[model samples]
Target chain A: GESVGLHLPTLSVQEGDNSIINCAYSNSASDYFIWYKQESGKGPQFIIDIRSNMDKRQGQRVTVLLNKTVKHLSLQIAATQPGDSAVYFCAETGGGATNKLIFGTGTLLAVQP
Target chain B: GAGVSQSPRYKVAKRGQDVALRCDPISGHVSLFWYQQALGQGPEFLTYFQNEAQLDKSGLPSDRFFAERPEGSVSTLKIQRTQQEDSAVYLCASSLAGAWRTEAFFGQGTRLTVV
Candidate 1:
């Protein structure tokens, strides 16, 4: 997510290495959390999602960790590939119907070959 | 074999012009959503539809921005008197149900540039 203020944080990593992108959410009531990968000019693609009930969830090469006490979330990608280069976003769903998503400040992942 | 499909993948318009973006959600999906993504930001919700009924539109930026899903299968987002700030990629997504089991599928999105 781009800051309403200015500029987005960036993450640089080498191919075949592990990459970790972190986010700090503002809402403590946010129960449903999701991680989305957005490439340039494209909509966010769902990477994986985890509920507040669990602390960790793992996918093929990706893992999401949630720390409710601190309202923090993190996505870890193993063996990062060039294809992984994109903006990573963490979304939260709270409040009510429509289940609108509130996104966090995004991190741009630049993978070096 | 089909995901959400959006029309006119790209749109360029002068300020004060009117623009319409179209989205065709997957068949049988009952929930539809519209979101706007600026530059490198995460998508911000604009509106949502459950079938032909617009359940929520509070996210719409202003009255100039309107959306309709009359048939429930296809939806359209119209921006009147487009401003430079309206330039962004509009995305559409659909989901079957929200019981925390079904996933939402998103379209490629329409890139709107208001010069």
Candidate 2:
């Protein structure tokens, strides 16, 4: 399960298990959202994204679910592997004044063997 | 270039010193962005440039921070009167389109430490 808050959260799971990461955005008008995975000493790599028009989108081994009523987003990894270990971030864009992604604190996903 | 590239992977500056971080985005990227990531935090938007025009700089934290992209291919982020609070990893990203329309590629980032 995933918890939503301002502080960074940690999700530890077995290599073959499933992992879920969560984020709560502040703006209600946000129209787009993205999930990024960042390895240590490296830049963020895009994993998946969901627009306001859709409540759920599926990618290879990953799924993003958006709950507009709660203004919440979640990323689920299927059969998580050690290679998936990294800090996962959820970013949002209201397409308003800034037109920039407003990123959440991030969640550290650790897959233990 | 094959991907986004940043210079001087690591930097340490005195509290009052000024520093410049550079970003070489992917070829033909129309949108370039600068972000600041503090320890254990996700990247925060600083500024954005569409080609040579700086369309958005509203994310810059203060007057001490400035960014420029004169020719549209490369960009620079400058910080003046750096303080301890200024220490963070500066990340640069670029996309094929403007705003939130596309996925952005990111550079490794420059770790700036103000001592």
Which candidate should be chosen as best, given lDDT against the real structure? 2
DockQ each: 0.49, 0.57
Residue range with the least summed lDDT across 10 consecutive positions in model 1 chain B? B96-105
- The residue pairs found clashing in candidate 1 are A1-A106, A2-B41
Give the top-scoring candidate (DockQ).
Answer: 2
Q: Residue B38, candidate 1: how far off, in angstroms?
A: 1.2
- Residue B81, model 1: Cα distance from true site in angstroms: 1.4
Taking the tens digit of each residue's C-alpha lDDT, what string does model 2 give over A30-112? 99899999999999999999988999999999999999999999999999999999999999886664347889989988889
Question: Which CAPRI category fits model 1?
Answer: medium
How many collisions per candidate? 2, 0
TM-score of each: 0.93, 0.94
Single out the weakest 10-residue window by summed lDDT for candidate 1 chain A: A1-10
